[model samples]
Target: MTDHGHNHKHASHKTLTKADAEKALNLVLDSVISAIKSHHNINITGFGSFEIHHRKAREGRNPKTGAKMKIDAYNQPTFRAGRKMKEACN
Candidate 1:
């Protein structure tokens, strides 16, 4: 199959290389992850917000043996789309 610039054209009429796009995406994702690790929330206007959600330890059932189990507490990263993004989707 032939590769293209995801059918997207830059304002300057230049198509971004796949590697470059991947690198850029990686950089952004890494930065967001680092911020979450630091307990900092990221809010990108017109894009979305990234934050961590904490869950307390709780009791759960084991599906395999139908036994009660203790679930450890953990922090989970979450994303909330901005107004602009939501509008764009609809």
Candidate 2:
């Protein structure tokens, strides 16, 4: 077998710090928030939407002892990927 010169691949990467990651995440959130404010909708092009969604309360079953439980409805933030994004994963 021949070496493909992959020896340096491991040394070339740097780990992102917590602060750096938080900043990056915040940047993405800021952009989305700005888009929502201006356009009333977020358009990630090939990626689906980031929007507000309302969930209705319903009854649910507990696995242990087979008991019925009440589930409260709440508004939730959600993402629905577009066709292109969905197709790419598959």
Candidate 3:
């Protein structure tokens, strides 16, 4: 809801094209994914943090058949919003 002007540092706001915006977004997303793949946590001040959460294997039930199933353990990517972001949302 606010224009932070953080993305206009290199180019004028009016000069930003669709491709530029996509590229910038892709770069940020790629960086975050790469960090997570490397088992590293990313902390973006005033925004949030990205980390991996481990899920233990557990027994689950099949909805249709009412049968028991074994769920495999996995690592899940999680996000926790920073205080500033939460405040802004409210």
For each candidate in the order shown, give its overall lDDT on alpha carbons. Answer: 0.81, 0.69, 0.85
Best by TM-score: 3
> Candidate 1 on 17-37: residue-level lDDT in tens?
556655666688799989999
Which candidate number would show the highest lDDT if scored against the true structure?
A: 3
Clashes of 2: 0
Tens digits of per-residue lDDT, candidate 2, 9-70, equal 32234365545555665687799887655545676788889876678999999988679999
Which 10 consecutive positions of candidate 1 have the poorest summed lDDT?
1-10
lDDT of 3 at 52: 97
Q: How many residue pairs clash in each candidate?
A: 0, 0, 0
Candidate 1 residue 89 C-alpha distance from true site, Å: 1.3
Q: Write the candidate numbers in order of decreasing TM-score.
A: 3, 1, 2
C-alpha positional error of residue 43 in candidate 3 after TM-score superposition, expressed in Å: 0.6
Off-target runs (Cα >4 Å) in candidate 3 are 1-15
Q: Which pairs clash (backbone N, Cα, C closer than 3 Å) in model 1? A: none
